[model samples]
Each structure stands twice: as C-alpha cells, then as structure tokens.
Target: MEGGLRRMSHHPRKRVEKAVGALNLAHLQGAFYLLFLGCGMAFILMVWESFMDVF
Candidate 1:
C-alpha cells in the first residue's frame, strides 16, 4: 500500500507540472496574438486619420 501511494504521488506531481507548462504556453500565445491585433488596429486607425486629414 505504501509503495502504491508513493508511485501515485509521483504521477500527480508530474501532471501538475505538465498542467502549469500548458497554462504558461497558453498565456504566451494569447499575449502575442493580442499584441499583433492591437498593432494592426493601431495601423488602420492611423491610416484612417491621415485620410481624414487629407480631405
């Protein structure tokens, strides 16, 4: 029984580590996507503003 518990404990620790790694990767991907979206929107806005000024 003790040996079984010890082995099970190792599995949970490994699972937790994997979950944390996945969460970090998700956060990084989301941040990069948001940054790209923001940059694109800003560029569009700048172009629109310049067009308005020209008119």
Candidate 2:
C-alpha cells in the first residue's frame, strides 16, 4: 500500500517535468522562426530600397 501511494505521487511529477521540457523546446523553436522571419523581412526591405534608388 505504501509503495503504491509513493508511485502515484511520483507519476505526476514526472509528467510535469516532461511537460516543462516540451514547452522549452517549443519556445526555442518559436524564437528560431521569429529570427528567420525578421531576417527575411530585412532582406526584402534592402532589395526594395535599392530598386527604388534606380528610378
């Protein structure tokens, strides 16, 4: 009975730990995507500025 109770308590902690790890991974991926998007926008603006200068 005592072992069963202990296992039950530990299970939730393990689940919470897994959830935290997944969240961190998702945060990292989001940051990576934002960085790429910002860089792409900067490149497009630079191109447009140069094209405008030609006219």
Candidate 3:
C-alpha cells in the first residue's frame, strides 16, 4: 500500500485538477447554455434534413 501511494503521481490527473480549480462559475454556466443551444439547433437541422450532403 505504501509503495503504491508513492507512485500515484499521474500527470494528466494533476493537470485536470488544476484546470477544474481555475474555472469561473459564471463562465461555466454560460458555456453550458451555449452548448445546449448548439445541440438544439443541430437536432432541428437534422430532423429537417437541411443540409443532406454535410450531415
């Protein structure tokens, strides 16, 4: 257990932790809202087959 604990310095996990800590709540909320809007637009376009070649 002691040896495993010492070897747990994974680089990607540390970077992700840093990034998560640095985010602003207001910006995150706005990003999510824009993502939701984009997905809704995509769904509508897909259903209507607006751009058959691109889709």
Clashing residue pairs in all predictions, respectively, total: 0, 0, 0
* lDDT by residue (tens digit), candidate 3, 1-55: 8777666767668888877866666678989999999999999988788567666
Clashing pairs in 3: none
Candidate 1: what lDDT?
0.99
State the number of backbone clashes in model 3.
Answer: 0
Write down the worst ten-residue block by lDDT for model 3. Answer: 3-12
Model 1 poorest 10 in a row by lDDT:
4-13
* Best candidate according to TM-score: 2
Show pairs that collide, candidate 2: none
Task: Give the best candidate by lDDT.
Answer: 2
What is candidate 2's lDDT per residue for 1-55, written digit by digit as tens? 9999999999999999999999999999999999999999999999999999999
lDDT of each: 0.99, 0.99, 0.82
Which stretches of model 1 miss by more than 4 angstroms? 1-6
TM-scores for every predicted model: 0.74, 0.78, 0.47
Candidate 2 RMSD to the correct structure: 1.4
